[model samples]
Target: MEGYSEKQLGILLVAERLFADKGFHGTSVRDIAQEADVNIAMISYYFGSKDKLLEAVFRYRMTATKAFIQDLVDNDTMGPLEKIYSLIDRYVNKMLNEQNFQCIMNREQMNREQSPVKDLIWELKREMMGLMEPIVTRAQEEGTFYKDVDVVLLMSSLFGTIHQVVPAKSYIRSSPEFADMPDDEFVEYLKVRVSAHLKKMFKAILTHEF
Candidate 1:
């Protein structure tokens, strides 16, 4: 978001959506250009290639998330547990708001073939895990979180739940309780429900208490 101009930002957003709706390989520079109402040459000039554009999209989304997590890490006011709760809330909000980008990430991760996008995603994941390590360690040292907690698996559980739930809107809507809810209401309802559920689950996991 910082280095990109308004036009570049617009192109990145359009590419994000197209890549999500149509797989990365399926979405071409021309498609992005037409959708963003820019010339193909402009995209070429900005991103160099479709692959680079894909990388830019991932970076554009991840940059903010990384900054937010770093801020939590640096903040002294919030205890580690409180930071974790804040993380849960932030992730829920992120997944809900950036569903399209999440979809692209989920799709790309499933591909076994090696590519720049996959490499970038893995790099980002490791960086994110590194950012969280100290918080988890601090909680353990403080005798608040469980000493035996597995950070990777714990994160997998947290992220996996949101990933599974956020994309299942149609299935969730089919349930009787939410059958009558409007789209706008359902999104807010989901954000509250998911955030509360994750907080409760993590509290138990981290503190060894319900």
Candidate 2:
């Protein structure tokens, strides 16, 4: 973020949309150039190659989320449950707001290949988990969460539940119940609805009470 100029940032934002829509392999440098209204030379000058640009896109998005989560973890006033709920709020908002980037991430994970970007994705994931692990462990140690709870599976449940709705936006929109809802209202509906559901589920998963 520091090193990038406005033009470079503009290019990356445009590339993010294109790469998300057209898959990294399906999108060409020319496509990015055309969409960003910059010349091919400018793209090469900024990122050197398509692969590098893709990596840059992944880094841009992942780093921001990682930093935000790290901040929540560092807040001393928040208890484990509060921190966990904050994480759920942040995660749900990101998935809904950044649907395109989420799509690209899901694609990359589903179709694994030899790429440096994938490695970066894993690194960011591990970093996020490291931040989350302590909060989760503290909950268990304090008897708020079940002693036998599996952190990884629990985290997966959070992601899995939210992502299932990403691909269903169109179908959901077309349904009679939501057909008249405005896009902004619909998104807020999801944020409130999904966050509440996950919070309830997480509470059930973490607590001993049935």
Candidate 3:
């Protein structure tokens, strides 16, 4: 018999991999059990069911995200652009090392389920948004961003761009132009791109909004 504690981690590891590659509906308990080198009975004994195990994988990613964003926000010395770089850096670095982390999030969202995990997912999103909102609001209020900018819209723009990076990384990495870009180089490019866009938007608003 598999050790109970080891089986739990094993199931999660396999489940996350399968979930990332094939999604929740695509992966099965048997696939996970086989990958983990454990018996299906052990999976049930540890997680009770496949759904529970899947949820745990999602929770793990969100927990890591919370810690990352919190750690960055704790550093007030980081300039707005630096903060953006930090955010992108952490995200890219995480993806480069543990691509499964990002895959799990994107896959879960694709499910579009109305299950109990819905609330947990929403709560996790709220934490990220809350972490981001204050920074944007402060920047706008302090005239770093253009006045009259919509905080919600800005927040969406920032996160939407960053969020797309994960699911599309393979495509980007395969592209000739991006194929040669290392993780740090890619993060810097993102920083430049995001900063340039926001700056242009701010200037446009300054010349047009008022």
Cα RMSD (angstroms) for every candidate in the order listed: 1.2, 1.7, 5.5
* lDDT of the structure predicted as candidate 3: 0.67
lDDT of 1: 0.91
- Give the number of the best model, judged by TM-score: 1
- Writing each residue's lDDT as its tens digit, candidate 2 over 127-172 gives 8899889888877788777888888998999999989977877777
Q: Lowest-scoring 10 consecutive residues by lDDT in candidate 3? A: 201-210
Over 41-123, each residue of candidate 3 has an lDDT whose tens digit, in order, gives: 98888788877886777676667777777766677788654665566555545555566756666556666665435566778
Clashes per candidate, residues 3 or more apart or on different chains: 0, 0, 0
- Please identify which of the two predictions, 1 or 2, would achieve the higher TM-score against the true structure: 1
Candidate 3 accuracy as TM-score = 0.68
* TM-score of each model, in listed order: 0.96, 0.93, 0.68
* Cα displacement (Å) at residue 175, model 3: 5.6
Regions of model 1 farther than 4 Å from truth: none
Please list the residue runs of candidate 3 whose C-alpha ends up more than 4 Å from where it truly belongs after superposition.
Answer: 1-7, 95-104, 112-116, 162-210
Clash-forming residue pairs, model 3? none
Better of 1 and 2 by lDDT: 1
Sorting all predicted structures by lDDT, with the top scorer first, yields 1, 2, 3
Against the reference, the lDDT scores of all candidates come to: 0.91, 0.86, 0.67
